[model samples]
Structure formats: C-alpha cells, structure tokens
Target: GAALRTLTEATTPALARRVAALVQEAVRLRPETAGQVAGCVDRRLEQGPTARPVLLPLVTGLLDGGPEQVRAALATVLAAAGTPASRPLRRELLESLLDRERDPAVLDAVLHAAAAQGDADMDRSGGGDMGRSGAGDPVEAPYRREDEIRGLVHRTGLLLVRTPEGATLLDRGLADLGRHVPGFAARMARWLTEAPDDWAGMVGPGARRTIENLAGVRVPA
Candidate 1:
C-alpha cells in the first residue's frame, strides 16, 4: 500500500489532470469486485465527453491486457454511467472497440457491454447498474433499493432500448480506423470477418431479441 500511496495521490493541478486518466489501469492490475471496480471507471465517465478520448485509450489497454480485465473495465463503465450514458455509450464504445479490437476478451467486453445494457434495461433479476448517487448511501446498487428501484430501472432501461444515433457508426465511421489499438488491421479483420450473427451468441437470452438478432452472432435457440 505504501508504494501506491504516491501514485494514488494525484494531487496538484498538473498531476490531477492526467492522473485521473493515467491511474485507471493501475487499479485493473488485479481483480476488484463490481462496486470497487465501479468507482474506478465511473470517475472518468463522471468527467465529460472530452474524457472520451482518454477513456478510449484506457479501454485499449484493458482490451490488450486480458479478458478478465477488459470485462471488469466494461462493467465499471456501465455501472458508473448506468442510464445517463450507458445506452448510447454502449453502442458507441462497442463500435469503437469492436471496429479496432481483435482480442477475444476485448471484443467480448464490447459485446458484453451491450449485454449489460440489455440486462439493465429489462431490470432482469432485479440487477442493473447501481444508483448513481454516491456509494454507501444504503440505497445503492439498485437491488438494495426497494422504494425507487422500479422507477429508476424503467428510466434507465428506456435508453438501452433506443438504437441511438451512432450505433451504425461502425458501418460509416470508415475513418474511425481503430488506429489506437494494437494490430489495427488484423483486429478489424477479426471483427468484420465474423458474421454479425455471432454477436448474439456472445450475449444470449436477454430482454430484447434486438441484441440477439442484430448482433453479429447467433443467439441460443
């Protein structure tokens, strides 16, 4: 812990700036529970769209690192944004990572992000992104909240239902070119090469068949 002390500080205006962006991955150096993980990713999502560029780079690293890391990272992102940004961001982030992503783990997260959104929208199993309110509020994690859960779930769920304006960007953003991730062209090949039907296989048995049907994979029967 002593070693991480200096690194975690992120003090000073200069260090604080990139510190938020830079320290994201260090937390992923190991496994963290969904809540702990959420705080890590949400900090950036709580930032601004300007942070999108930085967030994308962090995704690239997580994607390149390993499957588990990528999954947790994506989960943190979804839990943090929940409805405020999860739905549309899901499509955009997936399109971004998938377009340039080659690693099965990374690609899986992109697809899984869609799945998380699907699960959250339907309020399945009474699980979804936890409350956006500060953690430790007792009513956090959506599941624990009895009074407001239904309303919160409905509002957040609606966003995921919409196709969003940018879902099709992958088809047209021909210029997004995923130059950020490693093995760019080959990664694009891996994603494009696969049948969209396969994506359904990645996230099967959810709220809407849209995910199962439109995704580049086949959903379980």
Candidate 2:
C-alpha cells in the first residue's frame, strides 16, 4: 500500500521507474509480495497515459531477471493490467514479453494474456474480421497480429525443445489456451511442425525427443 501511494505521487519518470523496479525485486524475493506489487502497478496505471513510459521499462526489465523472478513479475503485471484502462498497455507489454522471453513460465503467462485479449477483441468485433482484406487474399489479410503470435509460439516451441521445464510450461499453456483460445494451441503445434531449423540443434538434451513428440516428426538420425 505504501509503495502504491508513493508511486501515485511519483513526479518524475526516474522516480517512477526506480519504484517499479523495487516492487519487482520485492516480488522476486518474496512471491507473497505479488499482491502489493500488483496494487502499486494498478495505482501507477491509474495515474493516466503518462504511466506507460514508467511501466514499460519496469515490465520489460523483469525478463532480464532469473526465471522465477520473471514469472513473479509477469504474474504481477498480468493481474494488474486486466482492466480495460490498462488493455492497450497490457497488449504492448504482452507482445514485448512474448517477443523476447525465454523462460517457459513467463512465456506461458504472456500467451495466456494474449489469448485473453484476443478473446475480448474478437468478442467486441462480433467475430468479424476487423476491416481487413477478404479471405481469398490471405497475404493481404490482417496478418501482422497473426505473425506476432506465430513468432512468439515458434520461439516458445524452440525453448520447449531445449529447456528442462519447457514441456511443463507448454503443457500448462496448452491447457489454458485449450479453454480460452483453442486455435492458439493449434497454431503453436503447426509452427512446431513447420519449424525452419531442426529443434534438436537449438539446445542440448531432450531436444530431439521433445520435438519429435510434439511435432510428430522424427529428427533424422
């Protein structure tokens, strides 16, 4: 509560960023502090449009921390940004996080946030294409969004083949998306199947087997 009050009163970007960083650090050290961090973020976000610059660095910098810390920071931000007022910033942060995050739990959180947003966006559009090209021209259609999601999923799949906890993270994300965004999971599976390079070469141990199991194609021996 004090952190949030201080953040609400923060007058300069420097001060705001510093406070945000401390909040993340606290969450990292003590996950029980996540509620406080979320509260601080929510208060800062309520400060209006100017909060973006302050929050951007705070949210993005969490990825540079240890995996557990990153997961903590992601959970904090995702919970705080669930409001309509924070939707735009949340989307931006989600995209940025998904773009570079390598940790499985963090990636899973990002995908969940994106899928939730997509569900909302789709609902608001009444399930219609958002004024894009016709179905006949897939290339000219609204592809930028799809491309971003695809790249993130592909990168995560690569990690799934590499990291020890990758399968657990992916399985969790798949289960979550299966409920809210079934197509997202399908897209990830498709990307894994059509990966440009061999997943085995990306990292050591469990790589080939994981890829083979998920993608249903054996790596040549």
Candidate 3:
C-alpha cells in the first residue's frame, strides 16, 4: 500500500496533464481513443473558453496524427476559440495544422482560419471574418491607404494582418522609418507595455504593424 500511495502521489499531476494532453493528442492514434477523446472534449467544453488555450497544443498535435475524427474535434475546439481576441493563437494553430494535416476538408478549415484574418495576409479583419475584396478599385493607378496597408502586410507577414487608417500612421513605413530612426520598435513596444485596460483595441505588435504598414497614404520621406 505504501508503494501504491507513493505512485499515486507522484503520478497525480502527471496523469492530469496527460489526460489533458491526450484529449488533443489522442486524435493522432485515431479510432482507438475515439470515445474517450469525445468525452474529454465534452468535459473541456463544459469548462468553457477558460480552458480553450490549454487545448491548443493538443489540437495542433492531432493535426499530424493522421486521418481520424480528430478533425471534427479540432474544428469544434477552434470554433470555440474563434473570438476576435483569440485570433493570434488561432492563426498559429492554422499554420501549424496546414504543415501537418493532409485531409482536404481539414485543410480547407485551416485555410479559412488563415484567410479569416485579412491582415494575416494583408492588413485586414472585419470581426475576424474575410469581408469583400480589397478595399479599393484595382483600376486606380495610385493605390489607396487600405490598399497600401494590405500590400505592406502581405510583404511583411502573412499570418496576421490588420486594417490601417490615415496617412500619418503607416506601419510598414513606420517600421522602416524606425529602422532608420532607431529605438522605434523599443519605444513602440514600451508604449504597448502600458497594457491599456481595454483589449478591444489590443492587438499584438506584428498584427498591428501589418495594419499600420497598410496605412492610407503615400509614406512621406
């Protein structure tokens, strides 16, 4: 009984983490853990979004585990995490899944995850849903600010993008200007460090830059 008690004490934490891990990882094994995984997911959902981030790694792990119902589970988990604030983590999940998952339907969902964030490829997002076409008539010679932000974001990073407004606030140009100006990334980083009480305006620096570079003006020299 002593040995058994020791084992239980030692394993309790590890087993708990494992149970959590297996919920997503079990998808890789496929079929074998199907029922158990479903139960785990149900329990996780019962706990709600508070636990969604913890589920990220497992869903990502199963993306490589081969053809299985895990895709359904992953889709459910991701859809749950699809709030505006979760966009960054969601983008990472999509890219990682793209590199792993071979199933076409699964891949399609991955693409939508990537595409839903317009600034992901360009500075864009209408509530994290892909809206209509680029915000300008392509026929114009001089591109508009939104067009520019879109172009710069595409050039900078394709994983996260955001829409920028006004001529004075160009992110890509600002990044470039900062390169010449120095302490820019540092200062900007510091300003953001203040952590405004409002997260509705909160966006990671990279995503913000994607939008910032896409600002609506010819960047000044």
Ranking by TM-score: 2, 1, 3
lDDT by residue (tens digit), candidate 3, 1-221 = 23322322233332544444444443454545543453344344444455455545444445555345656445434433233345445445544654555444443333333223223333233223344446452321212422432332232222222333311223334355334433333333333334333212324454345333434222111
Predicted structure with the largest TM-score when compared to the true one: 2
Residue 178, candidate 2: C-alpha displacement in angstroms: 2.3
Candidates' RMSD to native: 14.2, 6.8, 17.0
Q: Could you tell me how far off, in angstroms, the CA of residue 128 lies in candidate 2 after the best superposition?
A: 2.1
Between candidates 2 and 3, name the one with more favorable lDDT.
2
Give me the displacement of residue 191 in model 1, in angstroms.
20
Q: Which tens-of-lDDT digit does each residue in 28-138 have in candidate 2?
A: 676765555545655666655667877777655554553365454564465332544665676676667656666666555554654554455455446677663344433
Cα TM-score of candidate 3: 0.32
What digit string (tens of lDDT, one per residue) describes model 1 on residues 41-156? 45545554654655555444444443465354564365222544333453355445444444333333333333233335335324445444454443244333321322222222
Candidate 2: misplaced stretches above 4 Å?
Answer: 2-11, 28-30, 35-49, 60-102, 132-142, 179-182, 185-221
Q: How far out, in Å, is residue 118 in model 1? A: 2.8
Lowest summed-lDDT stretch of 10 residues in model 3? 159-168
